[model samples]
Target chain A: MKKESISRIMSGIDDEYIKEAAAPVKKSGNIRRYITVAACIAVVIIAGIILSQADIISPSHFSSEGTTANESGGGDKKFPETATEGTAEAPLDSFITPGEEIDTELAIESVTRPKWEDMIIPMRYGEITLGEITYSSQCTEISSENILSKLGEAKMQGYDIYTDTYYTVTGEAYSVKSISTECAVAVRIDNGEEYFIYVNSWYEPEDLGDFISDLDLKNTVLFRKAFIDEYKHSDTASEHSQRVYADFDDKVIWDMLEDCLSAENTEYNHPYDRIGIETDMPLLGYKNISFCITPDGYIITNILNTQKCFFVGEQKFREFDEYLKNNVPYKEYNTVYELNPDGTIPGKGEDGQSTPGFNPDAPVQISPPYDPSQEEAMSNTQQSSSPEIPQDFIIEETTRTE
Target chain B: MDDSKIITLFFERSQNAVNELSEKYGRLCLQISVNILKNISDSEECVNDAYLALWNNIPPEVPDDLKTYLIKVVRNISLKRYHANTAVKRNSFYDAALSELEEVLTADVSSENEVLFKELSEKINTFLGGLSRENRTFFVCRYYYGDSIKAIAEKTGNTPHLVSVRLMRTREKLKEYLRKEELI
Candidate 1:
């Protein structure tokens, strides 16, 4: 078809559309712009304070036992032991300096590790079998098959379910955070005993890997290596050998929660939204702990509260997907909790110290009460509102039954 | 003045109706013409012709929306002028918008078939109704109004790159829709 015919046809579209498009674009006033800037600054400052309190930047946090390879009892792969005389290793340097005294302590102090390495939490490995997989939204259960079918129908009918005003998924168990045209997000949430797996069969594993990497799981969660021998005796031995698992440090998780809370002050929603997992592994300490990428290419998780809905754009999504596809930790791991021999968390006792000779298959304890101070902080952040702030997708507490 | 008042003036045969219409939507009308014709003199002439058409037509045919009716008149007149100018030497600006739409509307729509034209327009409108508010606005401003990427970016409060990328994606969706409808 000639281009002019198409243009002429476009001219005949509904008049309401033409009027709407022709309407003057609203411009923010100077005062409102200043307030937005001020609000963004306040959010950043508050985030910095909360993260500082959690010791996210301090290298001292990594110095704790079980964090380092040598301290964790790595035999052959252990770091080189320091000799009293700085012997053979320093022969070339020693000859160059001859009789000059070397400031060994200063030299050691000068060397530093990358900040992200310090963020990695060391963890032990194990597995937990999941029970039923349920799909839900707005605190009510929905047919997963039905939603998937409708999504396909919508695409075939030349309409988008993601853009549909009423098409929203918000819940605790397996909330559909993002419904992108290309893929969907299905996350697993364990309810203390059995796991409720919400698997999105349409989800591209490559995208899932990317979404998990975007969460920066390796930095925030403890990497654990499972005892392949133990799995060898069990029916799921091959599964264990093929997959890796990690336990997240609640401190980092809380930092992210606070970050999302502070996000309310910003005018525009930041593309990199935080994803929280909702798993109640006693080892996980918290009842909720997970995150997933939405079908709309946004990574959103409401593991903590439905009030935490945020969006990242397609470019950022693609970048994260590419990263996860390339990274080994994200590609190889399944994000399952590593259980101790007695089915208890190895370091779940007082001050994170292990309790010896625990009972196996004992009922897992529920998470402690939500910290009142944190709750108050979240409430305070949620209450802050401005006309300039567009997205206030705080799922009402009433909608969340659990 | 309200559209009703403007129409009442037109019905009463008052010349002030044209003046009121010009005052209310002159800039927008001129801009739409400029987008298509890309010539200030020709755009102004076409807008004036549209105002005369509105004045002559309003007494016999009272439009539900005066601004929308006036805009359509101006846009149609401007497009005619653009087509005429293209016969000699093409106006790249409006041609860019036409080419964009041409990507999806590949059906052989004969000019003689008014029914086919109306059908295509209705199908496009239905497709638009299903889009998100932002996507619909972006598509209309780009295709219908012949807006430049920078202009669309400014209107939507987004970067030019973002606006361009979104338009490209929307076009892809439109292509898919047309294929399903057997229009292309």
Candidate 2:
């Protein structure tokens, strides 16, 4: 492992192999080389000719109508009108005087207006619907008889059923807007006016009942409303809302979930009972879920099972167990522990804010009491007592040693 | 001595050009070829081919860095032989090595080869130092010895990709370290 040893070994490799392997490079004569070079040049010329022809043809496909209209229309529109269109009131202009007469009539006339007949049909905002949900290994199917019966009633009432995927809310910055035993919904608001909602559910073929029981639908709706209200006053709400949805679609949320699961080393269990996740602190409710990663840190999955649940949903939990067996690739371990056997949460305690008995190996210790004045006096004493060494002396000693 | 003079000597059917080239860069070419091919015969053939090619091409082509040019020729020849001998059964070890070089090339195309060679030399040393004793031994035996992926996997008790990924990550880390040092 020493530097010298490695260099020696690297240098000591035999020379005969290099000479023998390089023999073929000398055998290929000038005729073959010339032909290869000529072929390459011909290919380049042909490619250039084809590319130039393609470039000439490409411009015909794009129409100037849309571009010209957008540009001219944008230029002719008065600033005041556009400002009013964005919001009901005109934004205050620091540079312009309020009493200045603006030529609104000519500007209004130049801008094209929709015909009265064309305005008859009401415009509707597109609604993003929750589709089938899929679950990774971390999430489990929830089983609550009450939720199952409610789902059955809802289905009978003609509510369309869909699939869902579950992800733990690792950070408070992102939380689910709604939950059912079957799914959890997260909403993001854009520009205070638009809303993007993501509904996640466990998607094994057989465990529909358990999935339904896991979500607390009422809390989800509340969370969605709260999120919308928080963003309504901000200018970025609309953009942020779209970004949130895009984040989910782009698998950013899933990727973050995977990171959290691996880092936490806790099994991603199914959504907690409606009673558990429906609290005022939905963010905290997310932290209660567990995730575990494989030893080599590749695959992550949920480790908790039915026996771990202390509530009165045993029969419904059994249905979930059966469903998982029939639909999902489920593996059972001996027992799931709430805390790691090492007694420390995987990622906490670096800054010493961790709970007591958190880590057995390196328990976080309480800092000794501080007296600022005393510490300042001690620092002064130490500085005064210490002798400064000459830089030249230090250099001389180092050079001599080297 | 000038490369043209050596080439002129070779073209004049004098074996002195080969002798001069061997005297100048015999050890360096051997090191590079053996590093890749890990065979004595292959390395020797590559060096000889480099000399013969130098003799034939030197009238028109003049190399600025004779050592690098010769090493490159030897490396290419050795790799060709390695590929032909091993066929498509190549695994993570070769892939990792190529990927490391590719990553270096892609990240900085200007002065890539020089920067890569320097960084690689430094990084391999750093990586060896950073590893646990067992891992260090395993790494040397695999990379330095040109041991196959299966051999490395069995010895280190790790999956081949794990080893490959680790090596790839180490190379990236080295590049990063070199960047921090302003070496690349």
Model 2: residues with Cα > 4 Å off, grouped in runs: A1-136, A140-402, B1-35, B38-99, B105-120, B132-143
Which lDDT tens digits does candidate 2 get at residues A35-138? 65698778766754664454422222111111111211221222222222212111111221334322333324434333212321111111122322221121
What are the per-residue Cα lDDT tens digits for candidate 2 across B63-176? 655554676566556655655665431442433445334443333323235544455455556544544343344445444434455555665565565455445444455456
- Give the alpha carbon lDDT tens digit for every residue of A55-125 in model 1: 43333211111122222233222222332222212211212222332233433453423222222111110
Question: Model 1 reaches what TM-score against the true structure?
Answer: 0.46
> What are the per-candidate TM-scores when only chain A is compared?
0.19, 0.15
Top candidate by TM-score:
1
lDDT of 2: 0.35
With candidate 2 superimposed using the best TM-score fit, by how many Å does residue A4's alpha carbon deviate from the native?
20
Give the per-residue Cα lDDT of candidate 2 at B116.
46
Worst 10 residues of 2 chain B by lDDT: B103-112
lDDT of 1 at A375: 54
Fill in the DockQ of model 2: 0.02
Q: Is the docking of candidate 1 incorrect, acceptable, medium or high quality?
A: acceptable
